[model samples]
Target: MEETRIRFGIMGCANIARKVSRAILLTPNTTISAIGSRSLEKAVVFASENHFPESTKVYGSYDAVLDDPDVDAVYVPLPTSLHVRWAVLAAEKKKHVLLEKPVALNVGELDTILAACDSNGVQFMDATMWMHHPRTVKMKQLLFDEQRFGQLKSVHSTLTFLAEEDFLKNDIRVNPNLDSLGALGDIGWYCIRAILWAHDYELPNIVTAFRDPEYHESGVILSCGASLNWKTNGKFATFYCSFLSNLCMDIIALGTKGNFRVHDFVIPFNEKVGSFYAVDNSKWAERALGCAPEPSELKIEINLPQEAFMVQEFGRLVAGVRSNEAKPENKWRVISRKTQLVIDAVVASIKNGFVPVEVVY
Candidate 1:
């Protein structure tokens, strides 16, 4: 039997969109139906250079892509400031939305987008690719193990990369009007997401932003850190994100009796495999010369990159809804809202003299 194909319309030609377009093309049940840019020539060039199918449409206005009857879903890679407007419109158009993260500048905008999707009966998902990686699932299995791993203790995540000269000067991420959240939105989103994932999506009771976030002259955050505590259970998590440091992506999670370290949590350095170092329990060496029990390196092979896996999962949900086989999954909306709420809390803490802010939702 032939399978149904979910057609995707891309809403921008941003650099990240180029990578996602490839993922859509590689997805088994998804196809690129069209791509739009503010300028017609840019859209045409993007399509040609990316070797898109001849049937793919090119449009000068975003509305054209949303209005296309062939477009069953839209992958939006627009700036953070434009997310609510376009995402809501896409849902209203009956097109499922695969939005790029930060998802929105704040939780209020995210709720507006989610409400539109719910009212219109469309699936909503954020493009946080790491969530779909096989390695992520393997790590979670270990975290859930009661005997091998004890109760969650603490977590620390860091993601940083020095911006290029042009990126530092002209990237939309650092622009006050386009993406005011800046590095916190562009880079820290992953760190926050990792922390929440490690905590089983539990909202923290308090969020305290680390003092003195680096800021651009335009009043946008370039780097920031925050600490979170989950009630009185003593579960703690901290994260640091920046555009001013050497390239690195790390997640160190410690449990009462075990621990693991993910050196490349965002995007694996090796295209074929994602790996981590783990230890269940350890003891001091004889005479206390050094540490005992070497950590084991675990690797998981992947047939596709994390992004393509994300698209495949999103397509599965959209296809189910299109076929009347299932309702849209609300998990995506749930996590995105949680992540955005924490982001809002961080911004509030920074503004309020780095005081601990109680998270309400």
Candidate 2:
């Protein structure tokens, strides 16, 4: 009897790790191998609180997880500041790396991580859960339908969640020494990724940030917005992300012939199913009244949450590498790099007096 399931070691007990641990357990081809934190007691308690299997190892140091012979991959939910150091180390250890987004402090750091993964021949994927949703796939199809969507004209997205007073004061996302980019790194990452996804991972030619982004006094961004433009095609995308508003995840994409809309692009309101609305060209009503053609509501049902699907896909890549000696999927690495490039450009735009910064990558 052969065991083909991929074993995942998670580093850090960050709150998001709790959901990822569950996703690893729920994914059919993946299993929790070890849980590690800087504090041994924290690791042990995290393993128990998360109900990890009795056989799962609890290590006090991240290096211990990477050294464990049983660990085939590592899920890194560490702070953005630690991503390059640990992700590169995990790759150096010959372990596949599933990193949380924003994957690094900047594009340069992300490249170092990617280079390590490439040199080590291990898979590299950022934890962008929504990209794996079936609903997102269907929406991409609708957007490319010549008769329906035509050329992509513009995109607008927003991802914001109200933070409790305590969270605003103490959460890692707000701590400049930790999450650093703050709201721009935490939630804005998704908005930028969504816009890039709409553009088929194409890098925008220019990025101009909105003025006076709300900042935490510590200089970490609390709320921000940016506009990306493809000068050649005259198409553009705009997005806003914040930690000081009621929760909202919306995407509106208008095309030459139609429009596409999704209210819950990051995390769907319904766990069992997700949906979006789209419309094709519709004529004006006889009396210039309301149009008769309504946008169609399309829904996608899934057996697992988007995170579990992410684990499943990542594990599939690891297994292919381990069993068949197949090359790791480079598309995921490319997708991650493009996302980081835009993030860096946005930050540069903000820093350079809200001037448009040319995207070098």
Candidate 3:
């Protein structure tokens, strides 16, 4: 029964890690067994502040956490640039990896990480919390229902938040050396993932970055947008991400017979429940005075946070592998690779003067 309970080691004390650490604690089959940071004091402070289990070990170096024989998995919330290095090492050490989003700087780096995990026979999953949300499952069911939604037409998504002056100036996200992709890697990752999820992970044929991306003095992106085209059937999608706008996370998907929308797609406005709107066969009525069918508001209640659900699902897979009952799931790996591939294409398009860049694989 040892495999039934998966012990986790946290790789960094990033702000996002705080939320995920709570998730590990909340998940039934997972526990935070260790936490590591470059500074021992910082690690200690983080463990204490997050109220990690008293038995949780604190290490001054990330290597120490990976070296722990008791750690069945590692939750890596490091920056995009550091993902390949740490995640690969974690896999090579025979530890399952729950990596943070934008999984890597590009597809090439992600491939390296995936290869390591494959060679070591360990699980790999990105920490895209929304994918585990009940609301997302319901939405997917509706989108796939031909009778209700018909053919998909287009999607528009936006994710933005106003960062304080200090963050704009001092945050690592805007630091070229640390998080060069900036807002694109941070918030934009969610927007791109949402679009892909809506399209059922089909790779776009061409990606074009919107003209005039705003960059910090360090040459890190602060705001950007992109348009994606699926050549075969002419399905198109657009997404925008920024750190200069008021709080907004929205997705609008239109189909031939129905429309779907969610104002808070990245993170629910309230932690306990989330809502989305949908309309089927909506049409004008009474001389265009009103619509015949009104948009329906639906809400999903969550007993545990979405991040917790993500952890629990990851733990289930790890347990299955540990018990010799199943192999590591590559579905999540493929999804992560496709997302990174699109991100790479978008960056390439921006560098090539906004020309359309074909997305290969």
After superposition, candidate 2 runs with Cα above 4 Å error: none
List RMSD in Å for every model shown.
1.0, 1.2, 1.1
Give the per-residue lDDT digits (tens) of candidate 2, residues 122-212. 9999999999988998999988999999999899999999999999888989988888999999999999999989998888999999999
What global local distance difference test value does model 2 have? 0.93
Off by over 4 Å in 1: 1-3
Q: Per-model C-alpha lDDT, please?
A: 0.93, 0.93, 0.92
Candidate 3 segments whose C-alpha is farther than 4 A from its true place: 1-3
Per residue, candidate 3 scores C-alpha lDDT tens digits across 179-211 of 888999998888889899999999899999999
* Worst-scoring 10-residue span by lDDT in model 2: 1-10
TM-score of each: 0.98, 0.98, 0.98
**How accurate locally is residue 22 in candidate 1, as Cα lDDT from 0 to 100?**
90
Pairs clashing within candidate 2: none
Candidate 3, position 331, lDDT: 93
